[model samples]
Target: MSQFLSAIIPNEKYYEKSAFEQENQKVFQESWYYIGLTSSLAEKNDFITTDIGGKSVVIQNIKGVIKAFHNVCTHRFNKIKTERAGNGSLTCPYHGWSYNQDGIPFGIPLKKEFQGLDKESLQTLCLPEFKVDFCGKFVFVNVSNSEVSLEEFLGESAIKLKEISIMIGRKIEYHEIPNKANWKIVVENTLEGYHITNVHPTTFFKQGFTLKSEVDFEVQGQHTNMTLHLAESHKDDKKRAKFHKLLANRPFQPEGFFHQLVFPNLSIGSLFGITVYIGSIKSVSPDESVFAYELYETNLGEGELLSDAISEVVKFSSIEFTRTTLAEDKEICENVQKGMEQSNATKGVLNSSEIRIWEFQKSYMNLINK
Candidate 1:
């Protein structure tokens, strides 16, 4: 990585409505996004709904196969499933128009009232379906109906993502936070640890998770990965050592903290694969975005499981730490967005430690400009 790299994206692009729309169509819609784990939709009729780019999508388990469809009814065009997730058939509350597993509208109340509406006509009214794929337990949805496969979109980083998903045992927490910042601003913040000391002083900084700490970066195609090496002092921390001792018999364990970005959005990280998190941002408008996250703990068999008391303590600590860190980041990102409105700066310089941010901007420019 170069010691210094100039920012490619203009500052104004961060809060411009035009830029946001273009990004919604070009970068987000055309690309794949990590929604949630496949396990979340394991049972029949189980579904998870999300907004990708500007499109609303619902992924559901029909019988045994997982399917993706537009979360809207054909009659009134109302959202079929409004909640983030639930277990129910794709039935629209507006007019009781229920869709089949394949998104075909099979049930419509007062059907005889409509004229020239045949069986094939019902197919036309089928909820528009999108592409869905999985990398291990991780589920991704592409709203554009693009020809690009998820594997192709993920490229070489797909293996690492699959590995991360395999390590997840159960979800501990999931949050969808609204931020007063552009989607790009929120994403760019995660690409660098430069603000760790200032923005996350008490949490990340105190834990020695600063850019000055030992770290490794890999810019793979459209994605990037950064691994933060554990400090000698932290390696010998009494609490961590005790936890390790409890799970020593496990065949596999999470050992390090690594953050991975799967292009446009989707940030996945883990502390020794023992606790994992996946976060992503979606643009609500030019100056607003929604941050969604899912936190998980490593899956361990009965023999390797930690005591409930010990696990609860670890879980509580992890949740509190992450919640605090996210709250800090949220305030700073919004501040940055506010500052962009007053700054006339054209280009920003990045240090070698922020190469991941530079790479992210490069990818963004390539897609946005194309």
Candidate 2:
């Protein structure tokens, strides 16, 4: 059978405010969002804040435990920690109310001034907390308090996710790119290798990356994943050998390159199981989104860090290559968004090579339509 598919989602769905609202409530809000790495919060009171579907969340490491809560202050609803990432006690700068790891207000400055305030009332004024879970050191926050756990949400993909996380070390690059495109447009761009020949000719194509024909797709529950190995032509390339030799003594070596999308918005990709990229696609509006990513190298165990020369090469190669690739994607996705509202067509067509995109669209439609 010819493997072609029609885009299940309509063009209007890509640029409509109503559709964005529905997806925010039903899809992103109800799902677990990959926020940041646990390596970033290595010490007590270390916290990273993020906004998911208009709700702000803060993940903190308190006394060796990772806790997540709404970033809002209970007294005035102002965001307790406005900064993106920091290390500090969970104290509201607005009114000097400090919360414990459980988010209950333990210190209310000038408590006697407030009339009718009691210990029970103080206990009830706890900061609303969300469910926090992890696979390896990758932290995920669920806002809806859904019955489904992170492992349940990830399904079989959890194995790959955890494997990738274990292979990786601390973050080396953190970037937040404002995309002038619908969040889905940004996401769908990452789902397929069909655009590699055109959109990433230099950044990806010239780098020995395989195109759609060589890509393998697998559907894991609502998630879609693709794996790519070295093309025959580049198998013996000297640069590839040098790159591989840099981590020849690592505990875990990557078999191939893989990209995985965890349902609604989280994307994880890795270069030979090392140099992993984790991104969360956050919806800002109907036609706007933020693509924030963190890049990490393979873990080399304690005191076994690569030499400065090797580390510099790794950092430079990881940053320059990924930055260029993402820049190309941002431009293309933005251009697509501009035409989305002007297109006369109802839906675009899909090919066998683009099966992952179709799988993603189906998962999206199933959730948004529910």
Provide the overall lDDT of each model, using Cα atoms, as 2-decimal numbers.
Answer: 0.82, 0.83
Candidate 2 versus the native: TM-score? 0.94
Worst 10 residues of 1 by lDDT: 247-256
What's the CA RMSD for each of the models? 2.0, 1.8
lDDT of 1: 0.82
Q: For residues 1-370, could you state the per-residue lDDT of candidate 1 as single tens digits?
A: 6689999889888888788888888998889888888879899999998877778889999888889988878787888898889898878988888888788888888899999889988888887888889988788888885788988888899888877765666568888789999988888888777778788878776765665567789989999988876655566678767777765654335355678899888888776666778888778998999888888766565434556776786689889888898899899999989988888787688998888988999999998878
Which residue pairs clash within candidate 1? 254-272, 255-272
lDDT for each residue of candidate 2 in 1-370, tens digit (9 for 90 to 100)? 3578889999998888899888888888888888788788889999999987788889999888899999999898988999999899999999889999889988988988989789788778898889988887678889995799888888898887777766776567889899989998999999887788788777667767766337778899889888776667776789777877778776455456678998888888887755788998889999999999888777665426666777777788889888999999999999999888898999998888888888888988898878
Q: List candidate 1 segments past 4 Å from native.
A: 232-235, 249-255, 301-305
What's the distance in Å from true for residue 120, model 2? 1.0
Question: At residue 331, what lDDT does model 1 achieve?
Answer: 96
